[model samples]
Every structure is written in C-alpha cells, then in structure tokens.
Target chain A: MRAEPQSFDRVLSSMCTEPHPAAREAAERFLATNPGDPGTYPTVADLEDDAVSLLGEIAGLDEPAGYVASGGTEANVQAVRIARERAENGRPTVVLPESAHFSFQKAADLLDVELRVVPTTDDGRADLEAVRACVNEDTAAVVGVAGSTEYGRVDPIPELGEIADSVDALLHVDAAWGGFVLPFTDYEWHFGHAPVDTMAIDPHKMGQAAVPAGGLLARSSDLLDELAVETPYLESTSQATLTGTRSGAGVASAVAAIEELWPDGYRDQYVRSQNNAKWLASKLESRGYDVVEPALPLVAASVPTPLFEALRDEGWRLSRTGDGELRVVCMPHVTRDGLESFVADVDRLETRVGLEVAGASE
Target chain B: MRAEPQSFDRVLSSMCTEPHPAAREAAERFLATNPGDPGTYPTVADLEDDAVSLLGEIAGLDEPAGYVASGGTEANVQAVRIARERAENGRPTVVLPESAHFSFQKAADLLDVELRVVPTTDDGRADLEAVRACVNEDTAAVVGVAGSTEYGRVDPIPELGEIADSVDALLHVDAAWGGFVLPFTDYEWHFGHAPVDTMAIDPHKMGQAAVPAGGLLARSSDLLDELAVETPYLESTSQATLTGTRSGAGVASAVAAIEELWPDGYRDQYVRSQNNAKWLASKLESRGYDVVEPALPLVAASVPTPLFEALRDEGWRLSRTGDGELRVVCMPHVTRDGLESFVADVDRLETRVGLEVAGASE
Candidate 1:
C-alpha cells in the first residue's frame, strides 16, 4: 500500500514547508504539461517565462536569463558549466568556501573542473582572506553560500564578489535555502552585489512552492546562451537545460506561489519563522544546550548524539550537522507548540541522564 | 493570469497522454514529501525503490541497480558518466547514431566526452556498418535508440549490442519513449540483449505516469556506484543523482501508475495506441502525404510547411522532423474523432492551397 500524506507540523530540519494551497492547485493544474517540449503546449511556455522573470526579480536581477531547474544541484551544475564555458583560461577551476554545498563537488566531478576549497571562519561564514589566497587566473567561478546548509549562516557575499572581480571570475551565489527569505530581509546576498554573475535559488525551499522548483538566474542572456545545444528533432531550436522533458507543473506552481506571497505575504511568514527560530534558540540555551544563534531560520545546537538519536526515536524529525550538531529549521509549518513539545522532550531526557549520573556517583 | 488546465483530448504530437488519474492522485498524496533527503520521511524512499524496481522489470532486468531521475536527460547523462568512468582509455568517446535524442549532446557537453555521431540509414534506423566503423578501443559506449523521437523508429539494438561487444564498449539503449511499450511488443530492446549495460526509460512518456518520472537502469551495482559523490551536509551519505532535494511526488506517482497499469492495462492501451497510429498513417498516405510507417505510436508524414503552419495556427498541436516532415503522435488521450477531424482540416487546407496555386498559375 502507498503511504499517506505526511503531516508537516513536526518537520524541523527541513528547509521545505508544506506547499501553499495555491501552489498545490497550480501543480495539479499543469501536471500533464511538459515544459521542455513546449511546441505541444505553448501556454506552459508562457507560464515558465513568467515564472523565470518573477524569480529573477526576487533574486534582484532586472532582466535575468535562466530557467527553473530540477533543484539546486542541477542549477549549480549549470552555473558551473556556464563558468567553465566562459573562462578564457585552458585550465578551469572553481573556488568555493568550505561551507559551500556539496553540489560544487558534484559539478567539479561531472564537468572536469578543478575545485579549490577554502576554509570558513569560526562563525561559519566564508573567510574572504582564504578565498583570495585560493583564487587564481584559472579560476572560472567563486562560490558563496547565501545560507550555509548546516548552520544557515549567510556568507559575506559582497566581499566575495570583490574577490571574484580581482580574478575576473564569475561569482555564483547558492541561495537555494535562503533565496525566498533573504529577499525580504536586510541581507546582501542577491545580485545587487556588483560582481555576482549567477545564482541558484529554489522556490520550493522557502517560497512554499511545490517541490522541484529551483531556478538558476544569470545576469546576462549571453552567459545562458553559451550553454545552448542544437536540438534538431524538437520544436525548440536549441536546448540549454540540464534535463530534457521537464515537468511544467513545477514552473506553474512556482509562479502561483510567488504571486500569492509577493509584496507582503512572504515577509510576514519570514518574520514569524525568524521569530520562531530565535525563540527556540533561547529555550535551548536556557536548557544548557550550546545553541548557534541563527542568521536565518535554522538553529544548530551542540547536543549529544545519543540524545539526538533518542529525540529522533521519539517521533521528532531533525537533522545533524557534519560536526554532530543538532539542527532545527524553522519553516512556516513548524508551529511554536511543536517546538515547545520538543523542548519538553529534551528536558525529560536531561532529567533522566542527570538521575543516572547521580546514581552512578553514589 | 495562469494558464488554465490544457485540454489533452486534442493533443496529437505528444507521446504523453493526460497523466493517469491514479498518477495525479499519487503526486498529490506525496506533495509534501522529499525523497532526496529522506531521513525525515522514510516511506517516500521506499516508494522510490519500489518504483525503480518495477521499471527495471519492465526493461527486462530481474535485478537492476538504478534510481528514478528527473527525466530522460538526467538518466542518459548518468549512463554516459558511468561509461566514461568505467572505460580504461585515457580519451573517452561515445558513438551514437545521428537519430539519438539530443540529451546525449547535452551529456557530451557537460561531461567533456567526445560524441561521435554516425549517420542513420534511410529508414531512420541506426546503420550497423557505420556503427562498426565508429567503434574502437577508445570508444567508451555505443548508444542505440529503442524509439527514434522524430520518426518513432526502433534501431536494431540486437545488432548494436553485437557491435559494442566486439569493441568491448558498453552498449546503452535509450528507450525513453518505448520502454513501456516494447516489452509488450516483440522487440528485443531490453537487457535480454546481453551487451546492453544501461538503459534510460521514462515512465512519463508511455507509462502514463505524471511528468518528471524517469529511471536509469544499470546491469551492475558497481557501475551506479561510480557516480556517487559524498554529500556531507545532507541526510543521504552519497549523492549519485544529478539533482538534490528532488520531489517524492514523481516516485509515488510512477509507482501508483505502474501498479494501476501492470499485468494488462498497459498492453491494452499499447494495442489501442498502435492501432490508432497505423490508422492515422494510412489516412495520411491516402491523402498523398508521404507517411513513415510508425514502429511505435508516432506517425511522421511529409506535409507542406504552409499547411503545417496553418494546422498549428488552427490550434492543432503537432511536431516536425528535422528534415521538415510533419509528425503526429497518437497517444492515449487522442481519440478517433480527434484524428478524423484533424484529417478533415488537412483535406480542407489541401483544397485551399490547391486553389491558390491554380489562381497564381492563371
């Protein structure tokens, strides 16, 4: 038998929330349309164009040339491919901070580009000095994370952009998790940074769109055109995307979600989500957990692995950082009551451990 | 405003029918689930595994190592990546017929693999003599198409397999549009042909699953393992896929669609669709259009560009061959009445064009 629809109320580590009702309806509305082969259905092509333009606006680009990819991985891979193609040097390399997502490694492996990993600072942000030392004439792109996957800390993109300019390398900001929220916040993570050339943003993550709604935005259409390959068989003259025959439902849902959340709805949700993360961090700190103050809506706390496993066993969905830190992402679906109940469980576990220690000491 | 749900009843150029109702329900049922990062929801992962296994069975594999990809592009790309990695040569090259899907070109661009395109025969089948001449010690893979996208012709996969074996090169069959039908047909396009190492099959094309449901099947688990990259930040230990954070809806929908169509449903639909294509081909030929007899459900015919454009302008969706042949794909949603009405319109256009020509001659 197939599984039932999962309840989103208890999900803590996920950047994705339950899709907005409008988004789900939009997906259902276009479930049969394949946007990749658009000649069969021109209406879907129009919706995809509108969706891409709207996402470009959200990323702070006036006229972005990009498409909604399968997810951040495909988007980032495409960004790296563009950088590789545009690089003047024979040996192409990409410089990324240690805090960058693993998709860069995947891209490096797939595209035969050299990947230079620079260490991040103690605060979990990309270290600018380290980046400068790593970048060279052969560097095709410099990658910065808008929201680091584990810690949810936005890298200093403005400084990274300046560093990229010195090397004449494209700056690709991976704003997959924070793209929807950072736009409404006072963060310098978008294309407003002068040297930013491309970005991978996912509406499915924080825009509350249905899944598989990731966009890759480029500052110039010329950069995107460099990746196009001739398709002699299809209606479209050329195809530049990483995937063939992509679903139109993702594009339609993203457009619907953005339309419903634009101007104020997203800002309101961001404020609430940020507040929830702040509240949860304080509660965990008070209970003796060494919490990392969230820059976005994700809070990472130093917790015992046994206790982490115990919490997971207790039906609470959570994730752990690479260094074994427990993380909780405050999405719109995660309610205050749910966090409180999780805190209550942590308190009980603490009490049980304390009693066991006391008995062993006696 | 968003485009309204398209009426698929009149769509003739698409191999995709309106998604099976069960497929749509399954997608909606798993809209909130993310199988890519499955630590939070294990059930969706199970569904994905089951879906992959079922698709492998359809591809004539008792035990296959694979995953559900975003579409044929990702699956074919993954197959090429596998071949490149496994090849013992320093310079890897893939040999494919000119009629292969455009995704191979995209893969060649992304993976830096030299793609050698051998010209097809007049009947739209891969030329065995040309393929034999192309294969060498440096050839990493030889690709054959189960169903040519433009002409709906099945390449001689059994002969292609023999050629690949002679060179010790991996043989990959791109059955994206034919996998669901060829098993029921007496076509030897699957793993039963021993030298076939990998296959890219799309459920969305002929399985009637919702969009974005494609699978990549490999003969051995070791081949699939070669693509795995360590993802330190996500729930999954290693990431082999082209995309991260993929939606579970595709997997669930595929599984549900397969379950609903298994045993006899697909075979019944296949017979009906094949009959429809044959009937359409006969009608087009009787009307003096040079029709290519379809091996699958696609019917390609030589129509004047003016008539083709007029048909499109009149809201009849269609695709064309690279050499400018008008094509009609008879999918499940296409009815007898729809084809009859389309033929009537074609007859009318022919008379109008004939009158214009006579008047010009006068």
Candidate 2:
C-alpha cells in the first residue's frame, strides 16, 4: 500500500501566501536560468538590478545597494551582519521589538551578537520607550517591524530612528510583508519617511511574486561594500551574499511581477485584499468573536483550540498568534467567497455550542 | 523606446551549468508550489524528502537527516554552525585546507568561529601534516574537500576523518562539485568509505538539477537537530533551514533529475565528461600549455595573459585558477566539439604568438 501524494492547491492554511498568476508564469518562463554565478547569465543579473531598483523606489531610497536574496531570513541576516561589521563597538548588540520576526533570533544566534528584545505595547506595536531604554553605547542596530507576523502592526519607526540616532546605531526596518502594500496605502512606513539605514523587504510576501524573492536594501553602497568577500576561484572578484549558487528564477519572476504591477496594478490588488480583510473582520465581530483591527491584510481573533483543530480538519488553513489568537491573512488567493464560507462554518459551530450549554443548564 | 531584455540562452561563459531538461520540466510542473510553508502544499515537501533521500543514498549515508538548502554556501554555513553548537569547547575553531571553497571563509565570519587555513601540497591536495598541526582541543570541525574549486583535487578524507576522530572534532566533507561525479569514479569520498560526520553536496552542479538545490547531510539526526529554530507564527513549530520561506522549485527539480538519472544515467554522463576533459587536457598540453591532469572534470592550464584575454574576446567562456591558470570545467553542456573548437582557437593564438616572437628576434 502507498500513501496519496499531497497536492499543491490544497494548501490553504499558510501565512506565506501563494504566488500570483503572473509571477507563476514568469518563473515558468525562466526555469532554465541561474543568476547566482553571474558570468554566464548577465540577463538575470540585470533583472536583479532592475528588481532591486524598483524595490528601492518603493521603499523611498534614491539609489539603493542591494540584491534579491533567498527570503526574509537571509535579508534580515544580511542586514544584521552589515550592522555588526559597520559598528566600531567591541561588543555588538541588536535591539528588536518583541514582535520582530524569528529571523532576528536566528541572525543573533548565527552572528554571535547580543539580542535585546523589548516588549510590545497593549495595541501590539513596538514600545518606543522600551526601545529607547534598550539602546546603549554598544548597540549596533535597532530593528523595527512593519507589518508584524501575528497582528500586522507597524512599529513607530520615526521614533525608533531617533532613538537609534542618539546612540549612533544603524536603523534597520524589517518590511518583508509591508514593502509591497504600504507603498500604496496611507501608512507612512517607507525609507522615504523614516531614517532607515537598511531594510529587509520581500516581494514574495505582498508584491505577489514567486517564493524566495526577498531583498536587503542599504541606503548607501558603502554599507554593502563592507560585507563583500573575495572569490578567487570564480570569475567574479568578490561576493557579499550569504548563499552561493542561487537560482535566478526568483529574480526573473520578481522582475516580471513588478513590471506587471508597477505604477497601479499592485495597488488595485491590495485594495481588494484589504477590503476582504475588513469585511471578514466585521463578519467575525458580528458573530461574537473579538477581532483585532487590521493595520494591513491580517486579522487576529481569539478562538478555542478545539475550534481551531476543527477548522484544520475541515481543510481550511489558518495560523495562530503567540497569545493563542487565530490569525487569518488575506492574500490574493484567499477570496471573499472563501472567507464568507469560513464565517458560515464558524457561525454553525457557535450555535451548536450555545445549544449544548442550554441543555446542560436544563 | 526601451532596451531589449537579454536572452537567457545567450550565456556561454559560466561555470554554473545549464539546468537539465527533466529538472526544467519538474520546475514548470510545480511553479505555484512552496514547500517551506507546507500546510498548503505537502507534495513539494514530500518531493524535498525524496530528493534528500536520493542525495543521502548517493553520498553513502543511510537515513540521513538533512534538507535541500539554497546552495553550497548555505549548506557549508549550516554544517559549520552545527559543529560549532555541538562542540563543548569554550572557543571554537574550524580547520580547512587552502583548496577548500570560499564558503568556509563566509561561515567563519558569520558564525564567529576561528578559521585555521592550512596550505595545500604541490599536487593541490590538503597537506595532512599541516592540518594535524593546526587541529587543537578548541577545534570544532576539520573540513576536507572532495573536489577543490580551482584544481579538481581530492583531499585525503579517510586520513582527515581519523585525525578528527582522535581529536573528537566533527569531519565535514564539502563535495558540492564532486558529490555527483566522484561516486561514479573510483574516488573514495562518500560517507560509506570515509568517516564523515556531515557533508555538503550540490545537485545543481553535476546532478544536472536546477540551481539552489544544495543539501547538507548529517551522520546522525542529533547533529542536525541542533540547528532547528522555532517559528511561532508559522504552521510548523520550528524550521531548520538558513532561509525562511524557500522555493520548492529547487527541490522538485532535484527529485526529477535524480529520478531521471538514477542507478546508471549519471555514471554514463560522468564517463563521457571525464573523457572530454582528458581529451581537452591532451590538446592543451600538445599546444605547449602546462596542463594539470584532471582528477575530476576540470582542466587547469597555464596560459599567457594576452592569449587568455584573446580567448575571452572570441567568446570562449572559461574560469581562472588561483595561480592565474585557465580553468575549463567539462560540464554536461560543454561537449567534445565545444572543447575541440576552444583548443583550435588556442592553437591559432599560440602560432600567432610564436610568429610575433620570431619577427621581433629577426
């Protein structure tokens, strides 16, 4: 006997969203290309340059020095590594909000840098006072989150930047989820408005590109140049990337996705997803669920563990927050109809629970 | 008017070989799949498992614990990180041969591990006496290269393994290029013959898979478990990868390539490439070039700087050795006809140089 192979289409419960149709098409078109060793394939390298330029424009940098990395983890790791190298302090430390992505922890461990995790406020945003208190003379970087993983709350970046400046620490913004959508929204969380020295942004998350299309942008080339290491065996003189022999398919797809969505295409899609999130939140709230007001496309609500398990068994994919709240992210593949059907199922479960309580009381 | 995008097929001078047709087909089949966040797509994750299993079998490891990483650099970094964590020493150091890949330099920098680079012998293999002298109680890992980047030389892995065992330090084998070719040859570099604790292998190299298909295999699951980190917001509890939200295309392509070339397919291809390399080496030697006998499929030869530049001008893509020798890697795409044409051009240039010298003397 053999087990049935899992289907790609059946994944509905992932926070890492699916690639857009155009992104998929782009990846398929460049399946044979590799951008890692750039000597043979200059085209993919050019595409990476274009993608990085477009990402810099979106993030409000004039001319950024960056590359399309593997994902947010690599980008964040690179950002921290740059800070560690640039800092003159003997003991390097990085300050981060409690809501920062787990990649920071990984970076802290891998780079052997001290991590000072500050708690978030009641509203699920980074505490500005806590960040200020955490920074010291040895602080290398102060990390702020935009579109946090659990609640999707943007940190107070302008204030954090000021705190970092007081101690001469580099400010790095983790905008892996917000870099795509926030540019079109009313939110002020880009490098243009904030004093961010470096940033980690992911086109795969909200730009609707294929998976693994993440970028680490530096305000100046000098910061990135500090990380370059010589490669004597290859044609290239030096490489600054954390990984060698990367796939160019991600860069190609990201370029194609950005070209299709640039100027206004992504804005329209964001508007749709944002509206869907708000609509879903309202539907849940009306049914007696405590829903968090969405800053982006994610909505968090409290639910029993049994209900969560039931939902999973029903083939509806979902995630949970650190405080044990159910999280629903409204990506392009998650439609309004799908949310409505999910709401109906929740309503039925609530009604059954109410009847069971009534019978027990009798 | 806009500039025309460069064609992917036009690249000819890259050591990064083109993807196999079967690998391309597999990638196209799962363009919309992501194996990292597996709740939504389980098939790609299963494909990753299958690919790792196949790689383990090729590396002579049974039921190896590992994942398909982004590339050789990531795999090497992860291996070093694991060694660093598992070591009980207060100050950790990694010893490597001078011919080891540049990724070790990166891992040492990223992980803050002390690197001891021992010089190689005249024949381009690691000097075991120097390596033994470098190892100490603080040494966490002793690295051996199966196929060096520039010279295609294999280090004495069995001897290195014995030295590592005596010191209780982990022995990691970097077989990124040789893992696919050496198994088919008479080389004793795999886990079956050598006492390797961990190994870094790349399917994108000679396995004919797409780029980004690098694997880090461990002798025991305990060593790999040390590198796992928890992701609170994700569906899975913890992730062992260096990059978060990686692409499944690499894993799928690797699996497809392995299935297509299993048992005897890769062996036949290796023999053909080996013959091609030997023929090219003879041709270069006949033309008065000091060519090194290829241990694998790479031919490194001394050529005049002017002639090397002229070959590049004629659109012949090649690499350079550390000692300024020309390197020609006979990959699957670099056919006998291609090598013959390259040799003819070199022959023409040599005749022209001889005539110029004669004219000057007259």
Candidate 3:
C-alpha cells in the first residue's frame, strides 16, 4: 500500500500550499493531456495561453511571450540561458545579489556561465553599488530579487536594469515569490517599471494553483523565439518547452485560478496573508525573540535552537534559513489558528526549559 | 473560462495514454505536494523511493539511485549531464545516433557540449561502426537508443557499450518509450545487459502513469551525486533534480501504477499492444501500402499526404515520423476497435482519391 500524503495543517515553511478548489478540479480534468504537443492537445494549449495572458497582466506587460515552465528553477535557468545565448561573446558571467535564490546557482551550473555574487545591503536588499562594480562587458545578465528567499526583500529592479543596460546585458527579475503581492504594494519591480527583459512568477506559489504552475514572461517576442527548436512530429511546427511531454494539469490549474481570482481576489489574499505574517512577527518579538520586518508575508525570527527543535518535536513543519533564523512562509493554507498554535508551543517549550540558562544554540 | 481538455478517443500518436485508475487517484491526492522539497513532503518522497525501486527491478538493477523527472526529456538530459560532469575534461562531446530523441539536442545546448551525430542503418538501428568511428577520447558519453522515435527499433546496446568502454565513456540507454515493454522482449537493454551506466525510462509513457513520471536509473549513486546542489532551505540537505519545487503528483502516480502492474500485468499489456500493432501493419500492407514491420507496439506506414490530411479531417488525431511515414503508437488507450476504424477510413479515402493518380503528395 502507498503512504498517505502529508497534511498541510502544520506546514509553515513550504512555499507551496493546498490548491484552490477550481484549480484542483481543473488539474484533475486535464491531468492526462500533454501541453508540450499543442497540436495534439489544442484545448489545453489554449488554456496555457490564457494562463500566460493573466501572468502578463499581473506583471504589467502588454504583449507577453513565454511558456509555463516546470517550476521557478526551470524558468530562472532558461532566463540565464537566453541571456548567455544573446551575449554571443567570450566566457559569459551572471551578476546577482547574495540574497538571490539558489536556483540561480543551478542555472549557472547548467549553462556553464560564471557567477559573480554581489553583497546585499544590511536590510537584505541587493547592494546597488556592489552590483554596479561587479557587472562588466562579460556580464550577460544582472539579477534582481523582488522577493528574496530568507528576508523577503525587494531589490532595486530599475537600478539593476540600468546597470545591465550599461553592459548590454539583460535584466531578469526573480519575482517567483513576490509577483502576486508586489502589485498590491508600492514597489517598482515589473516590466512597466523598468527595462525588464524577463520575469519568473509562479502561480503555484502565491497564485493558489497546483504545483508545477510556474510562469516565465518575456517582454519581447525575440527573447522567447531563441528557445524554439524544430518539433516536426504532431501539428506543431516548433517547440520551446524544456520538457517534451508536459502535463496539462498545471496549465489548466493556473488558468482556473487566475480566472477565479485575478486583481481583486489576489489583493484580498495578500492583505490577509500580510496581516497574518505581521501578527506572527509581533507575537515572536513580544516573546523576547528578534524578528525581521514582515516585508511581504514572510517572517524570519531568531529563536533559540532548543525552542525551535522543541516546536519541531511538537509536529510543527518548520525550517531554518541559511542564516540561523526560523523561517515562516504564510502561504494560503497557513491560518491565524496555525500561527497561534505554533506560538503556543514555543511558549510552552520555553517555560519547560530555562531559556536564559540555555543561552544561544545552534 | 478555460478550454475543455481534449479526449483520448482519437489520440493515436501520443506516447502518453490515459493514466491508470490507481495512478490518477494517487496523483489527485498528492497534486499540491512538492516532491522537490522532500523534507516537508516525506510521504510522497517515500513514494518516489517506491517508484524508483520498481523501476530498478524492471531495469535489472539491484540498487537504483535516481529521481522522477519531468519527462523523458529531463531524464535523458540529466543522463548526459551526469556523463559530462564525470568526464572532467574540456569541451566534452556526446556521441549519439540519428535515431536519438531531439531532447538530446536540448541537453547539448544547455550543457554546452558538442554532439557527434552518427547515422543509422537501413533497419533504423544505430550503425555500430558509425558510433565507433565518432567516439574518441573527448567523447563523454555514447548513447544507445532502446527505442527510436521514428521506428520501434532497439539499437545494439552491448556493442555500443563496448565502443563506449573503449574510450572510458559512460553508456546511457534512452529506453524512454521502450523500458516497460523491453522487459518482456529478448532485448539486452538494461543495467544487467551491458556496462550500462544510466538509463532514461519514463513511467508516464508506457507504465500508464500520468504525464511527467519520467525515470532515470543509475548503476551507482555517484552518477546522481554529480548533479546535486546545496538545498539549505527545507529538511533535505541537498537536491539533485533539475527543477526545484517539483509536484509530487508524478512520484505518487508512478508508485501507484507500479504497485498495480509490475511483471504480469505489464507482460499482458505488451502482448495486447504488440498484437494490435502487427494487426494494423498487416492491414495497411493488405490495402496496398508500404509498411514498416512493427518490431514493438509502434507502426509506421507510407501513406499519401492527401489521404493523411483526409484522415485528420475526419478527427483521427495522427502524426508522422521525421522520415514522413504515418506513425501510430499503440498505447494502452489505443483500442483494436479504434485501429479498425482507422483502417476503414484509410481504405475509403484511397478508393475515393486514386492513390497512383495523385503521384505521391506531401
């Protein structure tokens, strides 16, 4: 017999969440269709176009061109690969802040491009001066993290675009986690805001879609055309997706979720989630723990290692950041009750073990 | 609103079929889970282990070290990437036959590796001599096609293994579409057959799992370790997959399908599909059209273009090979009744428009 799937009640660190009802129904309906071969499955293919159109609207692009990638990793990797191909020069290099997601490292390894890591500001934003100093003629692309993994900080995308333009390099915004909520904020991190070449936004992350529903949006058609290869099999004449036979589950789910909740629904969700994150942050701070500001519905707190482990022992699905901080991602599934329960466990555990006596822990 | 999904009633060319009942149920249950972050979704991760174990048992491997890929494309690409990493040489090259899938081209482009394309024999199998001539000290890998896309031909695996051995290169067998059936046939195309270092066999294709259940089996754990990247986010310390945040749908479905059908159930399926392919091939031959012998459950026939268009107009979802032959893949969903309908349409079309009078149309 197969094992049961994990429950989402205690999951606090995962970027993924329980899919919406419409998304789940649509995913189940089209689970067997292959979106890679558009000719063979034109219905799902059209739905993919719908998903991209919605993503384009969300990212402030009038004429968006891209495909549904496997996930953020594939989208980010393809973005760097496109920049490298466009460079058409000597050994290419990619410049990014130290706070960039690890998937960029995967991209550098896959594309054989050199990586020039720049330091981030004290508040976790990309250090613009450091990025400017690192980017040279060899730089094929400069990355700006709209929603960093640990700190949830939005880098200066327009300034990074200027730096990339100085070297004729592309500006790829890693907005995989922030695209959904940044629109509700005053942050300038999209196509209309700057000279953005491409963006990685995932419906699976904050858009309440099923897993694998990752969006890669390009400002110009030429950027996507470079990825095309001859696909002389079915009705389609060419293919650009990394995988040959992609399931329609993610595509249909993205379309369903976007159709059900575009501007208004997502805005409400962002407000609720941001409030929950702030609530949890204040609660942690009140309990004598240092907490990062809840910038975008993600909280990072410095809890004693023993208390963190004790909470884990109490069945809280928790995780730690690269920097010894307890990370909490307020996905749609994470409710106020869940956070309250987590805090209650932390307080109970702290009382049982003398916190001052234990001191700092790993 | 999203477009409705296409029906499988007329799909004759797709490598994927309607997912098995057990597989679909499991996939729906785990649709929101992310197998890429196994530290959080341990249940589905365990199922992934179950799927890989079943794949190893079928591939004649004692211990398997691999993961569920997005599809045959990711699996094949990773196999080449592993070989290239192990090469530790400058500008590593990959030697493959003309019959290899186009996904290899994607891999070559992504990994910055040179590709030496060798020709195939008249029988559609890889020319052993051509492969031997192309492989050299710089060759990182020699590919053997267990099942060519255009033809149901299994290349000479053991001979290709010897040629790959001469250069101390890795041998990767692309059994993506053939792995499930080759076990029932007398084809030496597994870890036990030759010095096979890795294999690409998709559970989504012939194993009746949902799309994206591609498998990569390695002879040793070192091959997979070469692809690992530090994933200091969730519970798992490292991840080897090409994509991050992969859906657990594929892993759970692969495990469920394998549990339902391993040796006997798959053997029965191969017998039925192979018989269907032979029946269709003879029917086309009897109707006075040239047909390629169905070595497996795939049939290729030389059909005139106008009639092919007419058949398509009648809503018979079809495709052609790179060599312009009508390609019919007898997947588990392709019924004998469907083949009879297709044959009837072909005969009626030929009679309405004289075949010789057209003088062969494109």
Alpha carbon lDDT at A139, candidate 1: 91
Off by over 4 Å in 1: A353-362
A1-362, model 2: which lDDT tens digit per residue? 02133542323355556566777777766655666666655567788899889999889998989999988889999999999998898669999999999999899889988999999999989899888888999999999998898888999888888999999999999999878888877766778887899998888888878766888899998989877888885677888888888767778878888888875988887898899889988887887789999888888988877677777777776778888888988877778878878887787766776676678999
lDDT agreement with native, every candidate: 0.87, 0.82, 0.90
Candidate 3 lDDT, tens digit per residue, B15-118?
A: 99999999999999999888888778878888888888899999999899988999889998899999889996888999999889989998998888899999
Better of 1 and 3 by DockQ: 3
Every model's DockQ, to 2 decimals?
0.74, 0.57, 0.80
10 residues in a row with least lDDT, candidate 2 chain A: A1-10
* Docking class of predicted structure 1: medium
- On a 0 to 100 scale, what is the lDDT of residue B154 in model 2? 93
The per-prediction tally of clashing pairs is 0, 2, 0
lDDT of 1 by residue, A63-113 (tens): 888998888888899999999999998779999988888888899989999
The best candidate in terms of DockQ = 3
Minimal lDDT window, size 10, model 2 chain B? B1-10
Compare candidates 1 and 2 on TM-score and give the better one. Answer: 1
Error of 2 at B81 (Å): 0.7
The order by descending DockQ is 3, 1, 2
Candidate 2 lDDT (Cα, 0 to 1): 0.82
RMSD of candidate 2 to the truth, in angstroms, is 2.6
Q: Candidate 2 - CAPRI tier?
A: medium
The runs of at least 3 residues in candidate 3 whose Cα sits more than 4 Å from the true structure, single-residue gaps closed, are A355-362, B355-362
